[model samples]
Target: MLAAVGALIIVFPILLLLLNAFKSPVDYANSSPLDFPAALDFTGIQTFWETQNFPRALWNSIFISTMVAVIAVVVSVLNSFAIGIGRVRGRTWIVLAFLMANLVPQEMLFDPLFQLYDDLGLLSNPWSVILTFVVIQSAFGTYLLSSLLGTFPKEILEAAAVDGATRWRTLRSAIVPILRPTLSVLMVFFFIWTWNEFLLPLAFLNTSDSLTVPLLLEQLNGERQTDTTTLIAGTLISVIPTIIFFLLFQRTLTRGITAGAVK
Candidate 1:
């Protein structure tokens, strides 16, 4: 069936990566890529871990991604509340501006942001990447959340107002609870997106000590003399955190995605 084939297409590369990660360099070089390895090897994984200081890279990535996701979601909810619920003046123009920002490529803003961060002494600081992505990701988040909030049941808001709930109380007690699933989806997305970022981290986190997982993967890839299996092992390791994070939030993601349809 088409679905089976599509699944295979998506899964095959992952299988390949897993297979090769366990393969010794000699076994990989001597056999076809599809062939099973002669023996399982942990050297590549161990080498990559020890040489790249993978623990530090992982911590840095987790920190940056977590900060971006949390900050961006909070900012998005506030912005959307003002535009969608408050019906702020120039709301349409504000939404349009955010859309325009989303359209603008990150590459185009890199130079200016780089200079700005440098001036602020944020170069090599994780906050540089965290702040940049918080702004960028929240633009998309605000755009999406505003549209979603626009379609939110008006009766709910009116009922809250009738009950004498302040705006902050209403948001904390009502909107957020109802929108938890959607916000969880956005948090997962922002986390993964920030985790996988390369150029932004590469530009700002220039020191080897400050490098993220993706940057470490890039460095592994660039080393011409690095073992092919070792590089694949590094790639495999880099993806594990994202996979675990996604799986942990899988139910919330499904609920968020389906909540709109069910409602």
Candidate 2:
């Protein structure tokens, strides 16, 4: 009861944006900002999508986020197995260093990254964004998967080894299958985070051809004041992919979140 009320209070602003997406500009202005639209209409939304090159932005976002997730996940899984199962002598220190790295604010890293990419002639390149998101997400994914792998029952790995499995094969066939829930959490998170990330994209992406959804939304809102409804429409459109992605992975995410609660 109280929880429902709190949830509403938290998301009411977002609800308003959704409601405004379908409202006529005059109705948007004259009516209660919170009121339902007089007529269920999508003309403003259609116009916004048509004018804003949202499809291109959306595609760019999908590409960037997918690359980030796949690359990060692959890198993380290998490294996590290396440090967790292999148990190198200094693994603890390395894991601590990674966790500490995660504490550094992302804003502080962009300038140096931009200059490095500029020197490498990668400015305005999608790889620049894709690689940046991968780097940002890799540390967390490694730490997460390492924690899970380190604690996985030793018997399964031993059984695989007895069956003539090499370490890499055991990791591939045994550990990875067991870690799907946790991996899904990281995959879904990296995708959504990269999709919504604005700062690094804004700093690095200089052209319309590489603009992502967040950057496009920012440009649209910045370009006109009267397009509040249009901007609202754009935001709602932008969120659809993220919502769908989350829904598809909700079970894995829920399990990942609750997996460690008792431990």
Best by lDDT: 1
Local lDDT at 248 for model 2 = 89
Supply the TM-score for candidate 2: 0.89
Assess candidate 1 and give its lDDT. Answer: 0.88
Q: Model 1: per-residue lDDT, tens digit, 1-263? A: 99999999998998889888888888888998888878989888888887788999889998999999999999999999999888899999999998876788778888999999999999999999999999888998998889888888989888999999999999999899998878988998788778888777888898887889889889889989887878888999988987797779788767656754584
Lowest lDDT sum, 10 consecutive residues, model 1, at: 254-263
Question: What is each predicted model's overall lDDT from 0 to 1?
Answer: 0.88, 0.85
Model 2 residue 186 CA deviation in Å: 2.1
lDDT of 2 at 257: 62
Clashes of 1: 0
Worst 10 residues of 2 by lDDT: 253-262
What are the models' TM-scores? 0.89, 0.89
